[model samples]
Target: MLAWLLQRQRPVPIIQMLCGPSGEKILGQLRVNSHLREHLRTIYAAPCGVDVTWIQEYLDGLRIPLLTEAQSEELEGEVSLDDLMEALGRMVSRKAPGPDGLPVEFYRAYPTVILPQLVQCTERCNTVAKSICEEGQLTCHAAHGASAIYRHALRRLLHTRKRARLDPDGSADNVLNLK
Candidate 1:
């Protein structure tokens, strides 16, 4: 089982792409890659609905209290090999592998072998985060901003807003409490 899992899997092919904003289709590897890159650059450069000044004010208004040295040490100590194992055990096995292409199934099946490595990797990440935090950099917060719960809540809110907007009686604003 270990040997079979260790063997490399074939890469999934890029099968198709939309060539234009209006959904004109393009097929093939080279053209698809080039067109997709151009499309993504254009999309990424477009302004989102969020107001930068409002966001800046909101962040500036936040008054999160700093943790004491002991509290910081305690928080760091809370992450352990056992905690990593527990989290790994909770991961769904059938999800697609990341860029490394080693699936969750491999870790689930070989916890004893992988736990130490995972713990080390996590420790390194924690160290990097701590350094970034100490420097008063925004990178750490930005990188870890989206929790799973937050993502789910955002999705649910969007879905409810969409449903409300589709109602016939103009009650969507009332439902969402929109001005």
Candidate 2:
């Protein structure tokens, strides 16, 4: 995975251009290689609705630009980044920050809310792993992985937020303070 990460990072942007226009029929979704396109398509193939659109916007946040709308569509069959940006732009107009200055997406995807939920799910899986082992499993793995997942999710959302990045609700050490 480490080697793959280094080699395959560039294709992320390529996939975006492919998906926006076509919705789900994007071809060559990954630029460096198409090996992971199927897996990505599977992950994004969930029921089409608000949550899916939200994730598409978040993933769109990760795109790196390249201009080939027609050529790309000819090669692939869609405009991914365009659709994602459209969805995100729609969300922008809908947001009216409440008294707390938080958009509705905050309540839907808050770090505080998301982290505890992740921890609870991770803890259960770790407990099962511990029981299956002669020696107990380490809780730290689940803790660390959950924190990383939340951090990555937050970064994606924050990336989409642009200038209006989510504010830290606590101290500088709040990154790990999922509670």
Model 1 per-residue lDDT tens digits across residues 85-133: 6556556678743456778888788888877875576556656666766
Residue-level error in angstroms, candidate 2, position 60 = 29
lDDT per prediction? 0.55, 0.44
Residues 1-179, candidate 2, lDDT per residue (tens digit)? 99988897654453343443346554543542454655578779876555577778888898454524442232222223333333334455347433447665664455455435544654454445545453535465554454445333333333232212223333212332322
Tell me the lDDT of model 2 at 81: 39
- Model 2 global lDDT (CA atoms, 0 to 1): 0.44
lDDT score for candidate 1 against the true structure: 0.55
Look at candidate 2 and tell me the lDDT of residue 91: 53
lDDT of 2 at 147: 41
User: lDDT winner among the candidates?
Assistant: 1
> What lDDT does candidate 1 reach at residue 85?
62
